[model samples]
Target chain A: MAEGLVIVGGSYAALHMAQGARENGYGEAIRLISDEPWLPYQRPPLSKGFLAGKIERDALALKGEAFYRDNGIEVLLETRVSAIDRQARTVTTAAGANLRYDGLGLALGARPRLLKIAGADLDGVFYLRSLADTLALRERLARPLSIVVIGGGFIGLEVAASLATLGHRVSVVEALERLMARVLPPVLSDFMAQMHRGRGVEVRLSAGVQEIKGDGAGRVASVLCSDGSELAADIVVAGIGVVPETGLAAAAGLACRDGILVDDAARTADPAIVAAGDCVRYPSAFTPDPCRLESVQNASDQGRAAGAALAGKPQAYRAVPWFWSDQYECKLQMAGLSPGHDRLALRGAMAGGRFSLFYFRAGRLVAVDTVNRPGEHLLGRKLLAAGASLTPEQAADESFDLKALLAA
Target chain B: MVIYQLKDGSERRVDVPAGHSVMLGAVQNDLPGIDAECGGCCACGTCHVYVDPAHYGRLPAVEAMEDDLLSGVAAGRQATSRLSCQITMTPALDGLVVRMPERQG
Candidate 1:
């Protein structure tokens, strides 16, 4: 009931908004409301380290309990805000409690896009998103079983890699012709497919899930593909994609298009309202089009921007976007967005499993994808942030001193 | 507990559990200096800190990822400079002191 800043959701963006606001000298009661039972935690490791049991649950927490208490951040975990009244400047919780806020931040995040095929609702079919979902999936994976992972995006591939590493019979069914076709270039997609195949995972490209056949006891037994092929599967995990949680924002009459529209400062059309994280589509310095990014970098930076705006010192959120994925022995690190890059220049050998792909659009460095090349990836981020240009020839030459350009 | 020596010569002592990293100690306690932007993934070198020379030798060797990342840190690297996330606290190093860098990227 504190009449100050009220942030909705429990994730990176929400936590950062609270922290950023407090750090920016927002001396008021800040309340973070979330439907999740646990405090905000990192989602990146859920499919990799957490599923592989390399990372403990405690380590997944974004910040410790003492953080919220000491920072005067009132956390309302397991509480969902059902409605937002912009007129009254109050949020109505699912429990019928209305909390007033001088400013509101919507970090609604996103939800898994469930399969709409036949028998999709059967047991033994899961989606990985929250801690509860991961725990349930992990529990079901106690024994070795045939797992059919639908989709080949980051989540699906990470899950596929984890399950395959765990010695399970795994198959990746992708509707597209290549793995991670949307985000990765054709070459990297081929590399990913080859990598998965090398790790004993059956990579099924251009195979769409037609139906998930269920056992007589209501558990999934097999997955029927669009090619009329059937894969014997004891478990089905679909990571098709996610739909932004923009219903509340839209209902409250906020501008929304696939995601809630926000400015570079993470502020919505309404000056008193702000949005960040996966649920927001905002302007970016890297791209001409306003985009919505799902990486920890985007979430944290946008969250910080939202907090700064909430604290009355609004600055543009233009941090270079970067993402990382650890699969088996390969660490794929990508910096910048390469949506419309016309050319890709490779630096290093793919055979050696260490390389960097520089994506250029209209003769300008657009993005960089580096595999097992942490140094290149970090340099790419800096290069993009500085708006430094690199020629394809220079990028291809291994001996070219990339660090010298930072000084330029 | 872990002591974070701020760039301003101030010190922040926080009670971070043994299993957590030194970066977690500063972040969880709301210490201002360390950004830890990548959230301990060692992908971003923002959590760069200078370990006290006295306790620097006691810590484990820096891994390749951390080493590679340290090269890109904003404050520049030093012999005693280490990524706080790479340094997990232990009972043997209860009095470990890590000095925050001038800034993080």
Candidate 2:
């Protein structure tokens, strides 16, 4: 049995691999390391239910104490793996703890990128990523505060929705022309913008943050934008984007592109070393060239794949990517990876709220954004798994049931 | 074979196979109301069913996570509320009538 070190920033990938290793009879030491003080919890709900007071801190826990103890895995919290010495198969944590392992997994994940400005270092400036970040932001929710989210991506809009629901004035500024621009098309983005604005959230697109101004007390007071706008704010949250955690991997002589380069098996330059979750830029099942995914499905699926391979069940990871986000009254579910597409097949009705837009590349269905359409999303998941492509005309027709389309 | 009455007054009969989880039986036959989000791993706590008071000892011991997820539900959980995923269907479960809770957190 090989001892494994799953260096992780969060819990999802770490927990899954730990359990996988245990189930596969790897009785050796299975240790999980993270910078956070708490055990792993589901992060998808952090921006919605968890922030809205619907979910408590205990409810956010990934697994209870017994789950870890029963499986014979040791969890080390608030420990950051600063350096990785691949030749020695050892890792040095931030606190100077050198731990050796027979096999290693880099589920290090990514962090929210913050805007560099004067107010960025000031008080009341935030980024909603970890449970701690949510708890800190939740404390400000009850203070009758005004918020300015620096980006209109999923993170920003979700924060705006949560704040507005808590009866706070929220403004979202995005450098893109519309909201969710990275994942959705212009029309769908506009629809989401309308949805957010209708809920009384101030949504400003094409408005990049030039400088964040602070008050005399070192608190965020206002935001100065490229569009000649200055909005007053008691708090500022930077949800601009995220960069993959690849520094330790790079230092350890692992092949680093934009992310840790790996094959479909999620094996890096050293086959004994593997990377999963948001850190590894492994090959996509549908598209060409390797890519790094920051989504939960990518993390869990890749972790399971890598775990199985490490346990002598060697197989290439070829799973379709899927993710969902809950904002206000809508549950947006997307199946298949939503990028590298050429044409669109708009299904159902977007403005009415229940609709789906299919993203196709060279007449092959690559992705589908299903808003309140769980059936379409499920069918899309199956099709993408089978590499089954549907035509734009077939998907656009409301009479053609998604189930029938799948059978075709 | 077991017959259970739904909250809406509809009746659904399912074959409670031996050694299979009751939630697995309901899901395989599309009896509805059992949404096992974590795939019967007791992680998501979606397959919550309130067992009849008379049928408590018929199931296995309750695990920690299965008990924790039940605390978050809306309904008044009695001695029952077994995570259907955790219950392995046995010959003892024949003619068992466990009510499905209307909501899952």
Please tell me which predicted candidate would have the highest DockQ against the true structure.
Answer: 1
What is every candidate's C-alpha DockQ against the true complex, given to 2 decimals?
Answer: 0.58, 0.06
Ten-residue stretch with the least lDDT total in model 2 chain A: A1-10
Q: Whole-model lDDT, candidate 1?
A: 0.91
Please, what are the lDDT tens digits per residue for candidate 2 over residues A218-337? 888999988778999998888888988888888888888878888887778786777788877988866687788878778877887766655656568887887777788776777776
lDDT of 1 by residue, B1-105 (tens): 788889889888887888889988887676878887767767778889999999899899998777877888889999999999888888887888889888886
lDDT of each: 0.91, 0.76
- Please give the TM-score that candidate 2 achieves against the real structure: 0.81
Residue A381's C-alpha lDDT in candidate 2? 73
Evaluated on the second chain alone, the candidates' TM-scores are 0.96, 0.84
Per-residue alpha-carbon lDDT of candidate 2 for residues B1-105, written as tens digits (9 for 90 to 100): 656556686878877667656776675554557655444544445677888778777667876445654654445456777778777767767888788778653
| TM-score per candidate for chain A alone | 0.99, 0.96
Which regions of candidate 2 fall more than 4 Å away from where they truly are? A1-7, A405-408, B1-105
Model 1 CAPRI quality? medium
Give the top-scoring candidate (TM-score).
1
